[model samples]
Target: MAEPARRRPMRADARRNRDRIVAAAQEVFAADGARASLEEIARRAGVGSATLHRHFPTRRSLLDVVFHDRVEALCAKAGEHADRREPGDALVAWLGDLNVYAAASHGLVSSLLRDGPDADLLKRNDDCQAMITAAAGELLDRAQRAGAARPGVRVEDLLALVSALSLAAEQRDDDEGRANRLLDIAVNGVLLPR
Candidate 1:
């Protein structure tokens, strides 16, 4: 007789294993950088090294998966902010969140940007940058129209400023406070005379 088909998408045990692996990878990556070992990841996940290899055949695979996930999340947040608020507010909120995300992913981002193969992976999704830039541009236009921002600010310049602030914040022990302050300065500096 033919075997019965599985009712659900992922089996319960398989789901658990996948969740564990992702969680373990997050911790390992945070603590050990991109070079974190699969063996250590499996150990932390309470699975065998073979299982880890089965799930992620290479370190780049795992990093790519996580990085793409983060980028998607950031993009989604930007979309939501743009939809729900004034463009200037949306830009400010998104920029703050982006700073935090960048701080968290600094190591992986550096690795991806510096490594040739990984840089290709990062650049593969140009859509994310386009979305971000579009959102920033809309916000900047709104702020300028309202006379709340400088007339000639460009989204690219704002993005570079945000990135620099994020990197600087990452270096400080009080990163959260510093990031917030830097974001405040960025927003305030863009404002036109009351």
Candidate 2:
């Protein structure tokens, strides 16, 4: 096999520019979500559009890196729950965690789900979804095998539920506990006991 090409190290100023751009992207994404303007990010970072583009070739690419760490940590939290709780309990608890995270990250993930036209852009670019799916699948499989979850449950459906719950809660009143409360209702069901 031929040798792979070696990547050159970024210059000091370039590294600073990249960091500043990321910091600015975080702020802008927080403020405006997936629709945040790249030009605004560059302006906040004290860099030109060309410089920002040089660092991140596309908006999707920038978003991926900007939210990568949070996504990773969320997935990691799944692993933390798997062995600590009963399979069914673990699954429910993890969904609660995911609901909280999803509600908090409404800006970023709102664009990843099937919510609107802009969401399509993230469909192709998302490794974040894949990672979450894998993590959830592990806990889900355990639940099913242990008879904690019904066999018809699916990772995709679970994720979509969390996404939708987040959107609904966000649209409702400003009550911070609404998402978690909604999740409890969904998981426990709405029917009263006979």
Candidate 3:
């Protein structure tokens, strides 16, 4: 029987470069959407293309890492609210964070879903989506149990509502104002009657 391959810790400089590349990719992808340039990301990261490719050989791999990190950050934020805040405030605040995450994506998720058939890529995307939805559902359930949120609202409904509002905000002249207005309406609609 063949032995399993062993993994080694990354050297400090390589770890720094990897972190830099991921951060640069996030910023570039957010600003330029799905068609952002890898070379530009490398430049932004202060690394060579060789270094970037060494860490992420394919564009899809880089995208996956960037999105995975973002999703995990959102999950962490939601978890923090759930742990420390009042139930109603936790749901509302986490939903606000989710809205910001979706808005920052700028429709790149649609592009990602439609652009590839790579099984690994699709699976990663699905996993991230599940994580996000589960986080939101937990917050919602807490709020409902606390008599703050209305009963019977599904996580899918909440996510879809936020997605729509974020998309509309992107298309309008006053994006910040429009998104906040829409978010306020959605949040208010979900709350139990005073």
Candidate 4:
């Protein structure tokens, strides 16, 4: 039998609407948490609630779209960073970006960590973690090859350290200072002894 025909690409207008909706939802949900209303999202997107429903029938559907978009962006950033900088440097830079993203998204990361029907969301999140781990491992290997980093440092340990540091940074009123301090401590801890 012949294969089924491929669907046509979305029209520019439809694509614009979708992008607008996602942007609005990102802002609304970040500010208002998971209970952010669909009507508010539609208003922010300059679309009707019916239109929002047409695109995303439920809040989870909208969240899935927004969440996937963020993951793809983070993955792409990791690839770009890997290309543009030394592995360790790239990993460090990406960690900073991830912290900023987490801060801006406001509880999105924590919610993903929770178990539920959204457990798959956490699994997808693990893909990003694995990518970061691989990148960090490569960087650590490079630093080790250069005698710049401690020989025994593991990628998982480094990731855990960064996560803890980021959480600590988030708690501080002087977040920028805290983030810098966290990064400094992370870098220092990974450094080889003279």
Candidate 5:
């Protein structure tokens, strides 16, 4: 396996500039999604456009950094939820959180799913899907083993369902609420008792 490339630590002022840019980018992205302007981000960060470009040469690069932490946190949340709740409860709660995240993030998730120009740059560096699958798989396994979930549920299919439901919800006026509602419907399908 190839060893990951090491990053040199940033200089103090450069570090500050980068941190400010990330903060600005997060706000702008929340309000504007992936098409949020780089120049506007620089302006908000109180940095020159050149500084923003210097720190993040491409929009994809900046986005990778901006969303990376959130993905990590989501994976971590799965573990925490697993520990605190029953297996089925933890899976449902984490899926709810994932639904909200996907609905809110908007364009960023679509960008990550793209297989065009940015694919080459993101393929190895961005492991959001893998990380999520690992976390989700553990939860699903526990639920299935405990007989609280169906044995055939696959992590990939569950994630895809969350993404699709969230995308549909994003078109609604009540984004998160709609996403949660849709997820609950999926989670609890109508059945006739045998």
Candidate 6:
């Protein structure tokens, strides 16, 4: 098996610059979509274009970082939810959190799909999906083992169901309310009968 690539620690200033650029890029992308200008992002980040380019050479690279960071954060939240004693409640809570992540990810995901992804973006996308799937699988397993969830529920099924909810929520004026309602429906459907 291939060893995972090690990330070298960045110098303090470089790390700060990178963080600023990513934050700016996310805001710009949210406001202007993926075609948002890199120079504009650098300006918003309080960094020069050269520095932005040094950290993220391509628009796709910046998007990849933003997407990966969000997924990693979701994974962390899943870990927290999994630690809860009530397995069903944990799964439902994690899925609710996942719904929020999905909503945040909607714009970037749409842009990435509309534009052809580069090799690096595709690889990162695959890795992010794998991480999310693994987290969901663990939570689902716990719920099922506890007899809190119905038999035969799969992680992909939950993901797809939540994706639909997220899409529906995106179209609503009260997205948070709609998203939570949709997630509640999904959780109810998954729960085992008494």
Most TM-score-accurate candidate: 3
Per-prediction RMSD in angstroms?
4.7, 4.7, 2.1, 3.3, 4.5, 3.9
The whole-model lDDT of each prediction reads: 0.76, 0.81, 0.87, 0.72, 0.81, 0.85
List where candidate 6 sits over 4 angstroms from the true fold.
1-9, 116-124, 174-176
Write the residue-wise lDDT of candidate 4 on 1-194 in tens digits: 99999988988987888899999998887777666778999999998888888888977788877866775786677677778986556666776676566565546656544525554654655665675567567766776777767788887787677677667776776545686677777787787655
- Top lDDT: which candidate number? 3
Candidate 1 local Cα displacement, residue 55, angstroms? 2.3
Error of 6 at 165 (Å): 0.7
- How many pairs of residues collide in model 2? 0
Please write out the lDDT profile of model 1 over residues 1-194, one tens digit for every residue. Answer: 99998766877887788779888887788666777778888899999988777778888888766666667787788778878987667767888887777677776667666655666766766776776677677777876786667888888998888888878887887546887788888788776656
Candidate order by decreasing TM-score: 3, 6, 5, 4, 1, 2
Off by over 4 Å in 2: 1-4, 9-24, 37-54, 109-120, 189-194
lDDT for position 190 in model 1:
73
lDDT of 5 by residue, 1-194 (tens): 99999998879999999999998998887677676789999999999999999999988888888777678888999999999998888889999888877876766656545535554544654588788889889988988888778877788888998999988887777544888888988876311112
What's the true lDDT of residue 142 in model 4? 73
Show model 4 residue runs off by greater than 4 Å. 1-6, 111-120, 123-148, 173-176, 192-194
Q: How well is each residue in 1-194 modelled by candidate 3, as lDDT tens digits?
A: 99999989999999999999999999998887666799999999999999999999988899989989999999999999988999999998988898899888856765665555433564658889999999999999999999999998888999999989998998985547787688989898898876
Clashing pairs in 5: none
Cα-based TM-score, every candidate: 0.75, 0.69, 0.92, 0.76, 0.78, 0.86
Model 3 residue 148 lDDT? 92
Clashing pairs in 3: none
Worst 10 residues of 1 by lDDT: 109-118
lDDT of 6 by residue, 1-194 (tens): 99999999899999999999998987887667677789999999999999999899877889888878878989988889888658888888899889988887776667656766543465668989999999988999999999999888999999999999998998886546898888887788899975
TM-score of 3: 0.92
